[model samples]
Target: MRSNASDCDVLIVGAGIAGISMAAHLQDKCANLSFMMVERRAQPGGTWDLFRYPGVRSDSDMQTLGFAFEPWDDDQSIAPGGSILEYLRGVIHKRGIADHIRTSTTVISADWQGDQACWLVSVEGPDGPEKVRARWLYMSTGYYDYDHPYDAQITGLESFAGTLVHPQFWPENLDYADKRVVVIGSGATAVTLVPAMAEQAGHVTMLQRTPTWMSVGPSRDRLARVLRRILPRKLAYWLVRQRNIRLFDFLYHAARRNPHMAAEKLSEGVRKELGDLYSPEDFTPPYNPWEQRLCLVPDSDLFKSIRQGKASIVTAKIDTVQTDGIALEGGEVLPADIIVTATGLKLSLGGHIKVSIEGRPVNWGEEFFYRGCMISNVPNLTFVFGYLNASFTLRADNTAAYSCRVLNHLRTSGTQIAIARPPADGLVEGEPFPFSSGYLMRDLAQVPKSTDALPWRLNHDYLADCRDFRRNGVDDGHLQFELAPRVTDQSPVADQPEMA
Candidate 1:
């Protein structure tokens, strides 16, 4: 081990939206606190850098997707993938965030030492394995696995002659122009890929085992454009952000309250766009709206492609992967030059980094989510998990703000740790996530549940969280703050182990 090792007051894992937001917030709110961000990848942009698939874009609007402190001045509300990546990079450079980032550093495990009241994070950096000690640990790693996408098992895939591609690891030089492309999946990736690939591919076919509800709307935000023209830039951005927030909340709530009406409205829009091409059997999903996230298409691009005969949707089960294309259950064959599996991502927390206290492994599923940020009984740690019903950044920003408050409280109280102590009465168990999205459903067992009470429950309402995070105090009774006893000169050397 090196004589000198990196240590910080706070160690943030993952340099994605959450990590960047937390770092920026800590810098602004707790300027005196030393912190560093360790990202597994070589770059700062997490999702934007990871997914290089064609037609890759945010399912949510940029007004809400962009950081709260940073105003998105772009005319288009649904910005392209490249624009989002640029925005993330711009924030890092503009705020001098890169100085605190250690890219290509993967955190393998984090062990919290009760004696030291600090976490020893094991990370594999470019120089090899190293130890980093921090007074507090912030896990900003998102809920998906970056190393591998969800692998869908298909029969006879090895015998297929066509090129197979997954959107997660798109090839730069792979040619699909003027070639038959078949996208297998009915999620956002499939919806986005079919339309984008149709522009150049000879023809694109979306083969789905089940239908997913998709909403079509304009790419540009009319309200944002008008507000920008009439109002100051900051004011306009705030108004648009709030406007979109309310709009999304209302839509999601309405969908849950009245699925039949929501389904009709969603199906009607698709029918109107496709006209004769629309099939109720294919467009109408078995599940209600908001059961899974509604895929948003900008400018009706997917529908336009369908109408132009460049793209088509097929609702069927794949029986086998033929040499040239896919064979359906009923013996229907769809010839393809390339098969793109737009299957969803594999869900993982903290990029699959193992967390422990001493030597005992932490089972996240047993703990309650404290304020949707900190885990119950976990000291000096917070996770940035976004909302399922609204823009992800809404929750991201709130989590960062709340984390800053917690840090400030710990400093003021002369405490080294702040852990949530469950009430005498046990918490009421609830689902980890509100929605039943395939990704969440597939990995539900791994996620922790939320309690029924305040400061522990996963409140999906962003407005509630926004107000609570901004106006609420950090010394809530649920959180117990403590200062670890100082080590005396006569203390045994083995009592405090050396870092690796």
Candidate 2:
């Protein structure tokens, strides 16, 4: 029932920013090698294409979020969703990478064939199931799942007469205009949706099960424009990127090192904005800022929406859903024509695919991380994880650069397989992984903790990774490879890693 798929030197899953960037980088280094990128969606731009809620914009500035090869040419630093998607599409076209992408092709499973020492990838396409063999498999499926909403099973959800929509699964034809909307959850999605839906809806009530640290800053930076005019385009871009990087770095580090100081600085800003309307006790999180990402309300737009009486924030746990409203745990009833569940995303590290070597599954939770790139015993696979502070692209760029170096090294050494094995001690002592909740927590026990990984201490520090990954090779004595002498008129030998 399966068709044979075309073989390639490398097969990349996902056509999002990470996948595209990886392809672009690979093309630059190895021109002769063939690669194919498969995206489940009809188009590129993974999250950008999926999220269509109003007021959707990058939490990070475009300068940092954008690809390294292409500079985002726009007046606004904080770009809207449409612009970001356009930029990605343009990057795909300009790089001539569009031809290699297979849209609507979903990778079902990747199984390592020990006999062939290659990956036998099963993909589902329009035609049917197809199998493709590749020497290397690059997964850019992202750390989060694709628009799979985490809807809490409310008692009366099925009986509710009104339209119930999760932001991730927004119905295209659903009209919110003049309708009373209740937005559940208080994370970034809810914060962004409340103001956006408020614009069209008659009223929006943001219901939260818990408190989140919300910080408001200007959506559009006037200084960005002034600098753009004064300085060259590239220089301006670099300046803005660096400025934001340093600012975030300082704030994140200050919060980690001196929680009291960070809290004081954050409190001053909140007090000025809300005056007596907000209480510090209720709003402030028990954890330090950046313990989780501080939700950014661009240009105080969320606040403006609230000030205009279009939106209201209610901090309480929901008891259940009613026929036409929501009942709070404290016996309060709030009526709504639509319920928008803006709850958090379901985290799936490496797309939650079970990775196995031979017949044994690799326990990512129990493994030690090597240079934040390779997991111990995981050979020939390198994952690109972005920084928590700066733009994710920065860390991805470093990962690409490191990959180039590693590949080049292998080529020069006449090595067929390379792997990073953890030391025999089995215990990796370091800082806790930066992320605190969702699926990440569930699999934390098996995955490498941040403390064990260098330059991956939760905070985004690009310069450190730049120097480590680019300037120096894998430093922890972890990178291991198998070598086979080059043969005349013969393909490179495939060496499979030994599974535990």
- How do all models score by TM-score? 0.96, 0.91
Instruction: Estimate, for each residue in 355-464, the C-alpha lDDT of model 2 and write its tens digit.
Output: 67765777766665666665666666767666766677777766665666666666566554567765576554666556455545654564555554464333346766
* Candidate 1 lDDT by residue in tens digits, 260-305: 9999999999989989888987888889999888889889999999
Cα RMSD of all models vs. native, in order, equals: 3.1, 3.7
Q: Largest lDDT belongs to which candidate?
A: 1
Candidate 1 global TM-score = 0.96
Q: Which stretches of candidate 1 lie over 4 Å from their true place?
A: 485-500
Please list all clashing residue pairs in model 1, or write none if there are none. none
Q: Quote the lDDT for 453 in model 2.
A: 48
